[model samples]
Target: MLIPLVLLTALAVFRTAGALGVRRFDGWRVSAAHAMAVMLLFTAGAHFAPPSVTVMPNSADLTAMVPPQIPFPELVVYGTGVLELAGAAGLVLPATRRAAAVCLALLFALMFPANAYAALNGVELAGDAPSPLVPRALEQVLYIATVTWVAWPARTRPHPAAPGRDADRATGAGRRS
Candidate 1:
């Protein structure tokens, strides 16, 4: 939680400073992206760990508490881990960052059920003493917000070529007189 927040803040600061192509800030931006991705991977690992090893009220804990409707908890857990790792990897690469952001957003949405269960059951979280349903929901919301902030920069579409640009002209020439 704190780890993601700190990493995101540092990344945002570095990105803002690097807007003008400051050399030192570029290094920071790259470092920050790697750091954030690694932290997210760690988070994913934590969620996928077994019940005995996983801390309480986290994703794994919630998954453990719910009655197994499916035949294979292990498979589900590991599959989610794979997605998280892949998404984190994608986030670190310039070409795949936007896709990764979408993946993460979908992941967050998929986990909402477990989050709701944790809150409803008043489960004790890893760090928190014990919290009510609303606070638990809020905690999940905060995580969602943090992840969204980190991924927001990757959401923009590339700028179109300028008017009269050669590439634009090449594509449009056949349609014009």
Candidate 2:
């Protein structure tokens, strides 16, 4: 929990700084995108920590708690970690950003079930109990909103021939004049 919160704080700070720098210094979209990608990578990496046997019992315990459920918890955890890393890498490059954003949105959705389980079952963390389900649900909703905002497309480059394209249109560039 602390790890994720710390990573999220860093991401917010870097995002703000990047937005300010890009707006003021100009021509910084690629740099900003890269910074965002790195932040996400760190955030995603935090999730791979071995499950808390104390808080979240082992697979056997989980089965006891909620029996007849999916059996491969380790696989789920590692697979999610790998996807997150890949998505973070994809977001850093301009050519793959859009695809990365879509993947990240899916990832967020995919993780919701685990979050729900933790909240519903009162899964404890290192020192504290699980958060209230309502707040936990709201937090997930906020995460989804953030992902959506980050994924929204914006024009990164000024159009060439800004003035001349209008003139060309008046002179019937698209038609016989």
Candidate 3:
């Protein structure tokens, strides 16, 4: 709920900035990447947030969300926060954008089960009701799709004289019947 809103707000801001002459966000892909990075940073911060906010997951809530089988739930929460931070940084760098996008998409997929577990079991945090599974699942899917889109490589075109050289009409030197 709040996550998507954050992503959308960041996207709108970045795109508008680009339109208004911010060279870094001049393209849609760049804007989207930056927006997701902002969103990830927000989530990562939540992993370290104290148990004071009802609107977001805190460290304890996040640890409890992990299924019983997993060991050291606290460490998992912290590690994921670190991963999110790394992903956010990677997204902003041109050289690492694709890898980061792919990894983030996979991370979202892997993290869904914890969200599901928390929602299904009515795990409350900060005196708030448990998160609903359906909405959370939908949001996860949307995030996965967004990052997957970012991971797609740009298309490249071939040079004019590579292989199937359609010779110039005036010269007609390499034309094949």
Candidate 4:
């Protein structure tokens, strides 16, 4: 819930800024990429934060969500957190944004089983009620959709002679052509 809210709010804010002439965020895809990075940073911080009833679960507490077959659950939690941090950084760079978005999509898919396991077992973290599997799965799908939208490779650089409208649409500007 919080994760999607963060992603969407950041996206809306960034996209609005782009509409207002912020060159760095002048396209929808770029804004989405930046929003995803912000969300990833929020999640990654939980890996190191000390556990508390009032805050998110720490990485160690996240071990409870791991499926029984997984080894070193704590390490896995921390490692996934590190990967999220790396993905966030990668999404901010033009050269790496597509690759990072693709990887994060896969990460969301890979992490789904843990979500399911937690739901099935009623595993609670940070004193919150266990997240229902259905909603969690839907959220995972949303994450995948957003990340893959950013990951979709551009076919080619627009030929210099192409119409600006065509180029803008290709870059996800969402402007009328």
* TM-scores, all models, native as reference: 0.58, 0.63, 0.84, 0.84
Comparison by lDDT, 3 against 4, better one: 3
Q: Note each model's CA RMSD in angstroms.
A: 7.2, 5.9, 3.9, 7.7
Estimate the TM-score for candidate 2. 0.63
Q: Which regions of candidate 1 fall more than 4 Å away from where they truly are?
A: 1-36, 48-62, 65-71, 126-177
Q: Of the candidates numbered 1 and 2, which has the greater TM-score value?
A: 2
Give lDDT for model 2. Answer: 0.59
Which residue pairs in candidate 3 collide? none
- Scanning candidate 2 in windows of ten residues, the lowest lDDT window is 59-68
lDDT of each: 0.62, 0.59, 0.88, 0.88
lDDT of 4 by residue, 39-73 (tens): 99998888777666247877655788999899988
lDDT of 1 by residue, 1-177 (tens): 554565666677777767767655565435465555765677676666565663433555545534346556556657776887887798678777667767777886776665566556655556454346575566556655555555555445555764556657667854656
In the range 51-143, model 2's lDDT, one tens digit per residue, is: 454443343332222212656666665666688788778866667877777887787777776767776887655446766777766766665
Better of 1 and 4 by lDDT: 4
**Ranking of candidates on lDDT, top first:** 3, 4, 1, 2
What is residue 14's positional error in candidate 2, in angstroms? 3.0
